[model samples]
Target chain A: MSPKTLYDKIWDAHVVHEDTDGTCLLYIDRHLVHEVTSPQAFEGLRMAGRKVRAPEKTIAVPDHNVPTTAGRENPDNMTEDSRIQVAALDKNAKEFGIHYYPVTDVRQGIVHIVGPEQGWTLPGMTVVCGDSHTATHGAFGALAHGIGTSEVEHVLATQTLIQKKSKNMKVEITGKLLPGVTAKDIVLRIIAETGTAGGTGYVIEYCGEAIRDLSMEGRMTICNMAIEGGARAGLIAPDETTFEYVKGRPHAPKGAQWEAALNWWKTLYSDDDAHFDKVLTIEGESIEPTVTWGTSPEDALPISALVPAPEDFKGGKVDAVRRSLDYMGLTPGQKLSDIEVDTVFIGSCTNGRIEDLRAAAAVLKGKKVKDGMRAMVVPGSGLVRAQAEEEGLADIFKEAGFEWRLAGCSMCLAMNPDQLAENERCASTSNRNFEGRQGYKGRTHLVSPAMAAAAAITGKLTDVREMM
Target chain B: MDKFEKLTGIAAPLPLVNIDTDMIIPKQFLKTIKRSGLGVNLFDEMRYDRQGNEIEDFVLNKPQYRETEILVAGDNFGCGSSREHAPWALKDFGIKAVISTSFADIFFNNCFKNGILPIVLPQEAVDTLMKDAEKGSNARMVVDLEEQTVTTSDGESFSFEVDPFKKHCLLNGLDDIGLSLEKVSSIDSYEEKASQARPWV
Candidate 1:
């Protein structure tokens, strides 16, 4: 047999039919829907008089619109549109005979976190969601990507998608990451090198020693922001770390089924001689606890570097630099360490996992948040929150002057009340630094959980390494 | 969905690069499931001020471009998020087509399903259309899907490419899901084989 990339092997296996125009019908294994995007897709299905072809294969998760505060028990008290969107999901799930985990349910969380926790996401399967962070499931080697709600409806009516193949690119990381550097830093560094639009029309497969050294949660942080780099999807070949995480989960195969699954999954990696369209390599030792100074993910630089001037750019780059600097309200030669922030947000699907909290808690231990600075730590899932409490991480956060909130995508995109003030600078662990992402006119600087803790302690964008 | 053959209407010019979906529709306005009401809030942060007054300085709110029927944007328009609402808001605002130097892959695909034609042209061609669009409401442009061409009112024509399958669906107003379901038998057989070979999955 010819050597094939991991993507090619999975894609070829799922092709239902190939059309002459280089498009094919690919069978979908699982469909994950959230509150904000699924309502309209459900409406489209009803308008067409079409019932879901495979309700058993779909899971409805209502996370994006739910309130993270304690008073969320009464959905009516929520904002009008938010209540309507969430209530619509409950009704749609009942009408469509699909599984749903509402905010009241213990299982409810960010779709990306809950899907894998419940074992609904498996290796070698194709996963589709209406949210861009659907790529988070690619940590298990699934061919996962975000789709429009129109495609959501299409998938609901038929358990397949009319997808065209994408080019395959590999990013190889060599050497070992420095102690303070993390999975988020590596992905941020890659995005900075590749730029925001670099991965267009391609699937990025993260490989090599540094990638293999990370845990399943760490790998997920890398895959979650592949869309920020403009990649269609990000993948990491499943290995022992992936298998161990899936072994005893609720939906994972039980008893003898596990043996059979692992036996097949062992062959899911790419062969040494597999051909790739493009391969970019990075030295992991060069990575630092990175931070974004501008509005885009690709606008990151190491803490040691100063904000780059627009004049330092070439090829008509001044426009982008000037716009980002103008919006972020940063000077051209400003150093990241000299920047002070009004708030620190340590949550998001990107860094709200238990491991992320552990990293942050390690820095916050025996320390107090700076005076007049507000900080919050919101876990990604109810499950992660429980694990954090079990480890006493929640108490550590509270003692350190960081507000501990219930689980959701709180302060990530700030759909709920957890938001930054007008013109307030924030050190956030969430993915994007797009202008006003957290709130109206709120300036955000993206960092890792450890760095967010360091920023809180110092009231500025301080390096986590020296603090540690 | 609306069928696309040709269109002639005023084109709005937005020359900013990486016009992400969040910019088109902020998270605050993403609450409603309905697509129609979003037009009023299109470009919510950019089009409106903190107190909800229209920011007249923004291009879309200008008197001449308020009723824009087509959009001539910069490179990588709709560059972030996979929200179909971006196209929904565009269609709700009476935009029949969007012309850009290039588009993010997910957004480009979403436009077709929502009856918005996304045209990809070279930078030089886009610059020409953008200049023509600056002429305000009088500079109406034409997009002919049948010919795969976009023409400015000034007699400049630029040919483009479209996927034959997407083109067929748009022209006939055919069901994309129905066409995909035509291979139900093949899908069932493959599933049967897969389940048998890998029963644990």
Candidate 2:
């Protein structure tokens, strides 16, 4: 057999049929569905009178439009449109016989977070969802990527996807990360290094000492924003760290099955001799606790940097930089740390895991959120919320004058009521700083959990290292 | 889906790079299960202001481009989020073809599935068409999927590459779901072998 990259190995395993034109019918092992993107897909299935080919392989949750407030279980609490969408998912899930975690279910949360927590996203599997953040599952070495709603419907009806193999790109980071720096910073720095379109048409395999040192939760954070860098998916090869995390999970293979799975997973790494279409290397130490200063993730800079002037950019990019600056309402040459924030949000699939809560709590202990500054902490999932409560991390946040809210994708895209008002600036832990992503005319500065917590205390985009 | 053989219409010019999905149709508009009715809200935030009035400066709101069935955009058009609604809104707004220098992978794929032809032309060709599109409603561009070429009012033409399978589906207005059902036997046999080889999945 020829030496294979991790992506190639996974791709080869899932091929149900191959066309002469290189298009392949790939079997899908896991499909995570959420409210915002699945309604039209389910409607398509109904129009075609098709049944879900593998209901057991699908999981549905209502996260995007569900409020992160008390009494959120009541559909009436949501806007009519949100209520209708959520209700539609409930009807479709029950009618289709797929497993569902309602808003009231203790297991309900963000689809990406819920998938790994239940071990549904496993190594060597092809996992997909209608949400772009489906790349989050790549942390488990799964051939995971986001699909369009049309593809979502196709998968439901056939349990197969038409796919063309993506070129392989390898991103390696070396050296140890500095204190107060996290996986979010590493990924942000990578996006800054490679422009927003750098990873287009390629699947990036994140590797090297820095990547291996991260926990699975950290790995998830890195892969979650692979879309921000324009990659369909970013993955890490499964190793001992991955095995330990998957062990004993509800859906993970057990005993002999586990041993057999491990045997194949151990072979999931790219061969040293395998060819790569592109290679990028970064020094981990060079990355600071980073924050995005513009409407795009590619506009990231270290906390110590100044807002860039449009003239600093060359042609084609100068206009984009000017437009981003205009939308963000930042002045040229202003220190990033000097910018004030009206809101501080600490949650999303990007930074809503247990470790994220802990990191924020560590910074908030015995400290109060700046007076008159609003801050909130919405854990990624109900289980994650419960774990934080038991660990007393929730108490730390509440004591720091932060709103301890229910779990969902709260304030991430602001589909719910947790949104920034017009022209309000926020220091957020969610992915995507695109205009109106959090709210209409709302300006979002993406940061890590600890950085967000630090910002909450200082009422500005402050460096966490200063507090530490 | 509509069969897209050829389209001859005014091409609206939007030269901004990285026009993400959120800008196509904001999240608030995504709650609707239906694909239609989104044409009014296409580029909702840009086309309208906070008070719900149309922004006259936006190209789409201009009289000349109001009936545009094609769009000429800058590089990396549709660069963020895999919301299929982006293409749905474009299709609903009567945009049958979009010519760009480059496109995001997921968005490019979504466009084809929705009966919209996304033509990726070289920078020089795009520049020529972009200037031609600036001629407003009078400049009727021709996009022929059969010939895989885009021609401007001045008769300048640029040929593009389209995947054979994708082109077939677009030309025939055939959905992949119906096509895959025809191969159920192959799928069933592959699953049988796959289960034995790796039951853990």
Q: Model 2 fnat?
A: 0.74
Residue-wise C-alpha lDDT for candidate 1, range A1-468, written one tens digit per residue? 989889898898788889888999998888998899899889989997999988988999778778887778698768888889988999999999998888878788899999999999989889999989999999999999999998999899888899999998999999899999999999999999987778888999999999999999999999999999888999999999999999899888888888888877888988889888988899999998899998888899998789999888753246777888988889978898998998999988899889999999999999999999999998888899889999999999999999887778878888877888888999999998887788988899999999999999999999999986
How many clashing residue pairs appear in each of the predictions shown?
Answer: 0, 0
lDDT of 1 by residue, B154-185 (tens): 98999999999888888877768878778889
Off by over 4 Å in 2: none
Clashes of 2: 0
Look at candidate 2 and tell me the lDDT of residue A309. Answer: 98
DockQ of each: 0.69, 0.82
* Pairs that collide, model 2: none
Fnat per model, in the order shown: 0.66, 0.74
Encode model 2's per-residue lDDT on B55-154: one tens digit a residue. Answer: 9999999999999999999888898888898998998899999888888889998998899988999888999999999999988999999999999999
**10 residues in a row with least lDDT, candidate 1 chain A:** A312-321
Top-lDDT candidate index: 2
Residue B158, candidate 2: how far off, in angstroms? Answer: 0.8
